[model samples]
Target: MWEAPEAPPRLTVSALTAQIRRQLEGEFREVIVEGELSNFVAHTSGHWYFTLKDAQSQIRCACWKGTNYRIRFRPRNGQQVVCRGKVTVYAPKGEYQLTVEAMAPVGVGEQQLAFEQLKAKLAAEGLLAPERKRPLPLVPRRIGIVTSPTGAAIQDILNVLRRRNDGVSVLLYPAQVEGAEAAASVAAGIRWFSENPDPDFPVDVLIVGRGGGSAEALWAFNTEEVARAIADSTIPVISAVGHEIDFTIADFVADLRAPTPSAAAEMVTARRADLLAEVGSMASALTKVMHIRLLRERQALETLARHPVFDDTQARLRDALQTCDELTLAVQSAVQNRLRFAGWRLERAGNRLRHYPWRPYLQLHEQRVSELTAKLIAGVQAQAAVAQHRLAQALTRLNTLSPLRVLARGYALVQHPDGRLIRTTEDAVPGQDIVIRLSDGRLLGRVAQVLPEPEAKPDPPPHS
Candidate 1:
């Protein structure tokens, strides 16, 4: 009776869609699908909508920006990619799609392709230029390390330093060397050393790296941010990631590349003992050179001393002494002859003096002196009289031509107070003080007139 009354079961579109969505989402939770990408459209909402198909069929695919951003290379329309995701049914569109969580180029792995792509981009930009790389410090006073504190990298670096007895102090900047945040953490560590360097404990070179790991695990260093951080580092960066064969973008941009963490430590630290040994070697070489130089110089001087010139010195001395004796004898003989001739002249003079008469000569000289004295006295009086006559004539002539003499004859000379002679009335300004000079003295007065002299006319030419 109740079974007879049961009506046909009804299913709403929403309920049917919900059931399908749950089944698809649960069954296809994780899958790997290799297909060719087509109809690739990126929405403004940062969600990629595309269709992935092979020979048999095609299906819709979607990759959000958050997932796509982790992809190393941009996916193209015809690219063959192996995508990993879940199959989910969209309720609104009533469609089934692959929600891509990870994608990789089919031929080359994602990490390798991404590394190559980034390397080419950075190389083109000159960030990987050989000239941009810096030389390591000869003796780094302080060394900064950016790696996991508990990793083998730090232990390796420390062991090398301790073994070498390098005096460089260590500054550890702990950072995650792997995982999702590895790139940001590594970049932040590099930036901290570059931006917040302590002057008192200055760091010379920075070692940024980690121990060996798989390519997937070491992908952080291959990131652009890590490479840029290395490139922009102020201190010299030694990239010591993985092993000698494993290289990353950071290795290209770093100032130097170390094969391993131990090598990186060696690069930034130099043992004092090694430096001292080198210096000692140089000093020994210098001492040897100087000794050789002095020996050569002494030999040269000895050779000069034993020459023939020095050997004949005693003979030269004897010859010089003999010549000096002969010169002395000749000088003595000359002096004796000079003395005899002088003695003969003195004898002749003495004989002549004795023969001359004294009293008669004195009387004659006295008489001559008296006559000459009288004549001299008369000549002196005549010369004096002539000089006096000449003086009187000179004074008379001078007085006749003198302006002062004219002034004495009742004429006055006009002059300015400044001692300028007033040749015309124009020489003095009206109401200005003027000077009048008498024969004996000057006088000052005020000017009352300044009349200019009339220009003189040329005289008529004389009749021919």
Candidate 2:
């Protein structure tokens, strides 16, 4: 009967699926879908599989590697996304899915998201640590620059370098700084300088950057490949990206960051006026130190001249000479007294002899008196000579003990600023002021450094 309006044109399961797939692909070829991502899987074949779901419904999605390269941010589960793609069905499973051609996050920009993701990854790997950052050279002889040859950045840098220091050499590595191919070009320039260093004109520092622009125009510097190249460079890198307000991934990875290309040039070269100022400052400080030293030395000399030891030495010498003169006078006085007493005795004896009887006896007595007088005179002369010898010896010993004599023999007396003598290393410390007393004058100085005493060897192990 109409019984089977003759199941006219029966179709196989494969044919049914093919018909459905064609219908779905043709109708939703250019559709846009908004949903939350879930169950994302990145296959080894570089194809992405995931589910796009909303509170009310869900659909399967696939993104091939060839098409997903345009997506800037990495996809993750639970992220809301807006996808532009076509709908199709897998014939084998007879299931339907959306083939994603392009995609982006719902609220954030693709570049910003990509930047944050890369930043987090590099930070986790310790590339952003302050300890990893190297210091730029204080005085760069030759500066290497990587930037666009025709852009304003190169002109600004060259002008700054010329103005700051004409002697400093500059080598330019022309590179593309803004576009899809810019990252590789910039990285190649940096690696070229790093790999091929010029011995005759060595590049002391590197500047990699561009002039200010919109975020999209400056996206090349924010790329991970450029960042890694900067980090891997052996030479110190200075990142001079956009204006003061702009920040890029290269800035964080570089050894130093400059607000602008001109600022980087200024940092690498020293101004002539600044150099002269520094030299003048050092000279002024030295002159001041010398002036202070001379004043201290003059004061020290005046102090030594007025010391009590010199006065005491002079007083002792005077006293010794006075005692010698007193001893000489006393010896002469005793000799004179002895002569007078002898003469008196002789007169009395002569009178007694004249009154007494024998003439021969008187003559004999006169001879004896003359002989005794000569002997006593000789004894007094010997005593005076002995006294003179003792006095001369005493004067010589006193002269030998004089402090001035010691100083004249090239010995110096070291003392602290507070007038205490410095006898050992412990009494003086580095940077301490000290006075050195010489024969002619005194010197004022400061201790520069201190060294520890060497450990004494144990007598060579008793000659074992």
Candidate 3:
């Protein structure tokens, strides 16, 4: 009801805009806006002023140096983008503007497309082949870097290398990291470092890349010439381009790929703590090997020391000497016994010689001679007597048993012509010449006068 009274025609242009500015400043403490970028202008004062518009409307935006520094890439016209900022009204112009805190590109990213194209081309050329890659040097004496002289990438690499290993030297081959000739310049730097070897430029490995940038800003790394040069380089290369998510042709052709420049530096050198640990391990292993060898040798020596030849050589010699002594004593004793036996035999022989009597020998000899002479004479006389007696007795027996006696006793002995006495008539043959022996003499006879003696009977037994 009070609004009815025509409030003296409200405020003028300036006053109305000031009221709108106040209202807008309160309403948009923070906001999110999406549109296509246009009229992008970056001032020397480090401020980015641009316009965001669509088919329907447009809004002015500004990013001061402090906030603009956070942007990863430069904003270009025709790029669809999203921004987070606060909407505020300028009281002077009576206009609303956005103070952008952060901004990002919308839709399919442009940098991603460029990265894919470069990667695909390099892969087709066999630059990305696993076989083309070489192993990183185990201990790089010198490391080369190809990057913008003032870029943070070089600083990052230097920092890592210095911190990791102070012994390794770094050679910087400065070149533009962005711009038209950056690719060629970078590729030339790589070739120069590889071909030129001096005490100062004796690079064992090369790190070629820069800090993260948008696709357009990183285009130099995507060139075919750069990839070819990297693939052809004799020095082993490590490609560290952009952030972890970014890829480029140089990365594909390098012998090894690192996600960032810092990582590439780390690969070239070893941490001091890690190297010390490795040295300790090797020393321990060597010590163990030496210990094993020493133990084996000691055992062999002990075994030799315990051998019979080494431990008991003196005892063996002594035993042999004792045996020889015993043998010598036995021989000496045997000789003494033999000498005693011989001396005893000689003494006995001498005693016998001394006791033997010549007189007895002579007496025995004379007695034996006399006895032999007597026995010889007696034997001869006895034999003569016995012979004479035997002859006389034989003469008597002969006379008694002689056939002449028989003949003289009125018996006749008929003898064959051969002078054989015939005892029976059968011994005589008829008409054989014979001799009849008589006591007086023998008479010649002839068997023609046959006279048969009468059969005589056997003698009768004697009567009592």
Name the weakest run of 10 consecutive residues (lDDT summed) in model 3. 349-358
Model 2: worst 10 consecutive residues (lDDT sum): 297-306
How accurate locally is residue 171 in candidate 2, as Cα lDDT from 0 to 100? 86
Per-residue lDDT tens digits for candidate 1, residues 278-361, read 644644554455345435543543343333442234454344334434433443444344434534543443343333233354
Candidate 3: residue 181 Cα off by (Å): 4.7
Quantify how close model 3 is to the true structure by its C-alpha RMSD in Å: 46.8
Model 3: lDDT of residue 164: 69
**Cα lDDT of all candidates, in order?**
0.74, 0.78, 0.72
lDDT of 2 by residue, 1-464 (tens): 24675566769999888888888888888989998776677899999999888767889999999998788999876577999988989887889989999998885434556778999999998888999888777556678999999999999999987776655677899999988899999999999998998766678899999999866568899899999999899999999999998889999999999999999998877533464466446445544553454355435433433344542565654555465456546545654565466557556545533433335644665566567556655654564465456545655665667677889999998999887899988888999999998888889999998787998877655555
Over the full model, what C-alpha lDDT does candidate 3 score relative to the true structure?
A: 0.72
Give candidate 2's error at residue 175 in angstroms.
0.9
Residue pairs in candidate 3 whose N, alpha carbon or C atoms collide under 3 angstroms = none
Task: Give the clash total for candidate 2.
Answer: 0
Candidate 3 on 400-455: residue-level lDDT in tens? Answer: 55455566678887888787888877787788989987778779977876577988
Task: Rank by lDDT, highest first.
Answer: 2, 1, 3
